[model samples]
Structure formats: C-alpha cells, structure tokens
Target: MSIPVGDVTGVEFDRNTAFLRHTFLGLFFLLLSLVLTVGIVAAVYLGQVETRTDIAFAGFFGLFAVGGWNVTYGLLSRSNREVIDVYITTEERTHVLCGELADAEFVDACAELVDSDLPTTNRNPKLEAELE
Candidate 1:
C-alpha cells in the first residue's frame, strides 16, 4: 500500500519484534543441551552405570546445539516487513527510501491535513433543541 508522502519530523523503525520466534526457540534448544550435558557429567561422576538413555540424550544435546546455532543466524538475517520509511520535505520535492517503493510525487493542489490538529467544537444541546 502506498501512503501519501507527508512532512515528518521524526522517524523510528525496527527490523524485528522483541519476541522473535526463532530466537526463543534457539535459546530453548541451547539451554536444553546444557542441561543434558550437565546431567550426563554428574551421572558419570557419581559412578552410575552408563545406560543407553544417557547416550541418546548426549546425541540429542549435540543436535540441539547445531540446530540452535543455525536458527540464531537465520533470525539475525531475517527481513522485517513491518519496517516503515519516513519522509519529510520542506519544498515541492520529497525523497523516500521505502525498499522497493521510492520517489512518490504529489501535486501542489493537495494540502496534507494533520488530523491531530483538527479543532473539536463543543455542541450545546439546548441551543440545538430551540432551533429545531
């Protein structure tokens, strides 16, 4: 969607949300790996008989570490569509840098209105009733 170019005084944008799904998943995997490693080491130190379960868990931890590393990289390089480009101009010409959409021109006839600055007039009910 194309938004009319307006004279903006401020600009703020981000490439990613605070709670990125991949990032959280990566953290979960990495933490799960460390927990498994620690448990295996403690078991070995306590002279517990080595079981197939421990071996399986060690392999799972290794897989988690590898998967988590890849996920972290993917999350870092992901593009954010929610990012917005802000443009401000004091003259007839304006410049924009909205990824693919750039250099939007507007005729001088259309005056940009600031909705926030619109005046709100209070209506008197008695005055309206008398007129009716």
Candidate 2:
C-alpha cells in the first residue's frame, strides 16, 4: 500500500538558491556596466569618438540602474519565499513529491503516516552492506 511519508518545508533551500542566482546575475551585469563605462571614458579621453559618447553613456547608466534594482529586489525577496518537499512511502520503495506548505492537512497526514511507520528496515543490499 502507498502512504504519505512526510513533508519538509522551509525558505532556506529555495531562498538561498534564488539569492545566489540573482546575486550572480546582478554582479555580472554590474561588472559589465562598469567595464562599458570605463571603456567609454577612456575612448572619450583619447578623443577616439565624439558623437557616440552620449549613446555610450546612456547605455552605461541604464545597465547600472537595472542591475542595482535587480540586486536590491532579489535580496529583499529572498527571505519571503518558501519551498516544500513531500515524500510518500510504499511497501516497495519511497517516492518524493512536492507541494506548498500551506496545505496543513496534507502535511499532517504525511507526517502521521511516516511516524506510524517509524524505524523502517533497509531492504536494499547495498545499503544493508554499508550498515554492516
């Protein structure tokens, strides 16, 4: 018979992953903007171009503004997010599932089912050998 195993819920997993991804993207854009700005300044100082300086400056400022916004938004939203991992167990094996933590009934059901089946025996030979 199939039965719900349990649910694991927290913001840490999703939050950290999202935070890192956003942070990396934001930093990358910021670095790109800095490089472009420096390049434009150097070119203008060397008198290499006269008409394109305005366009370059606009692009540089746009990147800086957008990147800064993204970094701030990502950091702020990180703590407010959450993720849930659910598991179901059967006589043969355990299966992983996912859902929102707001489903309290589901979480309770799964936790109870798993708790009732506590101290499960390891049937896999590899795992058994490892235990030995």
In terms of lDDT, the best-performing candidate is: 2
lDDT by residue for model 1 (30-99), tens: 5665675566567668867377886677667657656655665666556533222323332455344332
Model 2 lDDT tens row, 2-22 = 443344221111111222235
* True-structure Cα RMSD, model 2: 9.7
Clashes of 1: 0
Provide TM-scores for the models: 0.30, 0.37
Evaluated against the true structure, the overall lDDT of model 2 is 0.47
Query: Candidate 1: misplaced stretches above 4 Å?
Result: 1-30, 40-49, 73-132
Return the TM-score for candidate 2, rounded to 2 decimals.
Answer: 0.37
Query: What does each candidate score in C-alpha RMSD?
Result: 14.7, 9.7
